[model samples]
Target: MTHRFVFPTLALALLLAGCTSLPAIDPAALPATPAAFKETDPRWTAIAPAEAQPRGEWWKAFADARLAELVERAGRDNASVQVAAARLAQARALLRDAQASQSPQIGLNAGALRQAEPGAGGRGATLVSAGAALSYEVDLFGRLSRASEAASLDARSREALLQSTRLLVQADVAQTYLALRAIDTERAIVGDTVEAYRNTLRLTERRVQAGDIAELDAARARSDLASTEAEAFALERQRAQLEHALAVLVGEPASGFSVAVAADTPPLPQVPAGVPSTVLARRPDVAAAMSQLQAARARVGVAQAAWFPNLSLTATGGVASPEVSDLFKWSARTWGIGALMSLPLLDGGRREAGVQSARADFDAALASYREQVLVAFKDVEDELAALRLLEDQSQAQARAVDSAARATALSASRYRNGLVSQLELLDAQRSELRNRRQAVQVKAAQQQATVGLIRALGGGWS
Candidate 1:
C-alpha cells in the first residue's frame, strides 16, 4: 500500500514541477495616457469656460423639459444602443470561456455490457462499470493567463463602445428635436409675413382702381404676395421633414409621430469647457481605444507563451472482468495516471510568424489609439471655435434684425403719411422679413454649436 501511494505522489509532484506560471508584463509600455491640450490661439483662451458640469442631463442647461425628456427616451430606446449592449454581452461570454480553460475538467461514465465466447456455449454475462476521469492542462508559460487577460480587455472595450454609442444617440436626438423646433418657428414667421403681404396687395389693387397708382405697381405687389406664399409652402414641407426625422431618432414610426410646436423657442444652453485632458477620461471612444491597446499587448504575451512547453495531466479509474458479475470485484479494479509534455521543437517558423503577427497587431493598435486621441482633441477645438464665433455672429444678427425692424417701421409710416411710394414700403417690409428669418437661423445655429461642444466633450461621460 505504501509503495502504491508513493509512486502516485511522486508523479503528482513531477507534474506540478513541470508546470510554470506566466511572467509579469509591464503595464506602462502599453500606451501613455494623453496629456492636456494647450491652445495658444487667442480664440481658445478667450472663450474657454473656467468650469464645466460633466455629469448627467447636460441638456438641462437649456432648461427645456421637453428636450430633456426626448433625450432620455432616445437613450433608452435607440436601436444603436441595443446593438452595443448585445455586443458587450458577447464579449463577457467570451471572457468567461477563456477563464474556464484555466481549470481542470472532470466527467463520469457508467455502462453495462454482455459477452459470448466461441469455445463455449454463449451465456449472458452482465458487466457493469463506473468511473470518473479528470484532465487538466497546466499553463506553464502563461498562455491561458494571457488569453484571459485579452478577453477581459475585450469586454472592457465593448463596454466603452456601448457607452459611446449611447452618448451619440442622445446627442442626435437632442439635435434633431432642436431642428424641428427651429423649423416650426420659421413656419410661423413666414405665415405671418405672407398675411402682411396679402393685405398690402389688396391695398395696392384698390389704389390702382382709383387711378392713384399704376397697374404696374399693383402687379409688383401681387408678385411679392405670390413669392411670400411660395416661401410659406416650402417652409411647411421642411418642418414636416424635420419632425419625421426626430420621430425616427426617438425610435417611433414617422407616420404617427409629430413634435408639438410651442410659440416660444428654447433658450440656448450654456456650455462650460473643462480642461482638455478631462476628455480622455470622459470620452468613451478614448477609453475603448485604450482598452483595445491593452488587449493587443496581451496578445503579444499569448504569442510568446507558444515558445514554451505545454503540460497536461490525465487520470482514469474503472473496473473490468471477463464475467460482468465480477467487474466490481477488487481483483478487476484498475487505475492509471499519466503526464504529457509537448514542446514545439520545430514548426517551419510558424511560432516565429505568430510572434511577429502579434507584435504587428500591437503596433497597429498603438497607432490607432494615438489617432483617436488626436481626433478627440481636434473635435473639442473645433467646437470651441464654433461656439465662440457663433456667439458673436448671433449678436451681430440680432442687431441687423433690430435695424431692419426700424427700417420697416419708418417705411410703413412714410407710406401711410404719403411721404414715400408704396414700392419703397414693400421693399422695406421684405428686408425686415428676411432679416427676421435670418435672425431665427442664427439663433438655431448658436444652439447647434452648443450641442456640438457638449458632444465633443463626450456628453459628460465623466
Candidate 2:
C-alpha cells in the first residue's frame, strides 16, 4: 500500500526463498532389493529379449483363437475395467487442476448494487461496475510446484492400477475357459466308458440265460454302467455352473452365453521366469505401488512448504460508471496492481500436524511398495513349482492309465473264459476309469498354473 514498505517486503521475500527447502525424494531410501529369486533352479531360466514386452498378449501363446477373442471382449466390455479407466480419467483431471494454479487466472466480472445515502433524506443511488481481472500466485516457496508434482504422480499411479486390473480380468477369463474345457474332456471319457459297460452287461445276461454264469455277474455289470452314467451327469452340472461364471466375467448375462463342449484340453504354454527384480519391475501392481510412494513423498514436500510464507501478484483492469450507457468510456476505466504476502503467524499446531501426517503417508506407501515386490516374486515361484511338480504327476498318471487299461482287458478275457470272477473284472475296469480321469485333472492343473505364471510375470514371458 506504501512505497516505504515495498523495499522491506522485497528484501524479506528474497531471504525466505533462499533459506526454505524441502527434503528430496530418493529411490535408494527403500529397503534392500533382492538380486534374484530364491527358487531359480536349473530347470528355469531368464526370459528372452523378444519376451520383454511381447505386445502383452500372453493368451495367444496357447494358440486358442476363441480365448483371444474372449479376452479382447472382456477388455472392451467388462464393468470393472471400465471403472478403473474412469478413475484414471478423474486422476488426470485432478492433475490438470493442480497445474492450473501456476498460470495467470483471468475472469470477467459485472454487477449492480443500490445503496441508501446515510444522513440524507432517504435517497438511494445505483452503482454499476464491469471489468476483467487477472491474478497469479507466485510460487516463491515451491508450494504449488510440490502440489503439482504430487497430483502428477497420483495420475501415474492410477494408470498403472488400470493395467493391473486388465491383467487380472484377462487371466481370470483364460483360467475359467480352460476349466470348462477340462470338464468337457472328463465328460467324454465317462460317456465312452458307460457305453462300453452297457455292451458288457448285455453279454453277461446272455451268458446267464445259457447257464454259463450266475445272475450275480449280470447284476454287477449293470451296477458299473449306472455309476459311470451318474458321473457323466454330474460333469454336465459342473460345466453349466462354470459357463455361468464365465459369462458374468465377460459382462454378459448367463442365460445368453454358452461354450460348446470340447473333448480336448487346451495347450499349456511355457511361461519364462526372469530374475526376481526384473520380473517385479514389469508387474503393474508393483509399478502402481511405487508411483503411490512417490506421490506421498511429494505431498510431504508440499506440507513442509506450507510452513514458509506465500507470495502472490495480482492485477485488475476494468470500467466503472453509475450509468450503463457510459460504462465503456475511457474516463470510466479503473485498474490496480498488488503484491500480497500471507504468513501464518500462529495456528496452534496445525502446520506441524500436517507435516507429520504427510510423513506417515509416505512411510505407508513405501511399505506397500516393498510388500508388493515380495508378493510378486512369491507368485512367480509358486506357479513355477506347481508346473514342475504337475509335469511329473501327469507323466506318472499317464502310465497308470495305460497299465489299468491293460489289466482290465486281460481280466475281461479271463472272466469270459471262466478263468476269473466277475468281481475282479469290474475292479480292473473302475481302476482304469479313475486313472484316466486323474490324468485329465492333472493336465488341467498344469494349464491353469501356466496362466498364473504368465500373469505373475506381467503378461508375457518377461
Query: Which predicted model would earn the best TM-score?
Result: 2
Model 2, 1-462: lDDT tens digits are 576876676677668657755555555755455544555644343331122233367788888888888899999989889999999999999999999999999999999989887888889977789888888998877889889999998998898888889999999999999999999999987877786788678778988999998999889888988887888899989999999988877899999998887788778776554433344456788778878988898888798777766778888888888899998999999999988877786999999999999999988888788788668768988987898899889889999999999999999899999999775786787679788989989999999998898788777653
Clash totals for all candidate models: 1, 0
lDDT of 1 at 354: 93
Write down the TM-score for model 2: 0.86
> Model 1, range 36-63, lDDT digits (tens) per residue?
4353132232222112224477777777
lDDT of 1 at 10: 50
Clashing pairs in 2: none
Instruction: Indicate the residue-level lDDT of 59 in model 1.
Output: 79
Residue 203 error for model 1, in Å? 3.4
Off by over 4 Å in 2: 1-32, 41-55, 117-122, 196-230, 272-280, 408-427
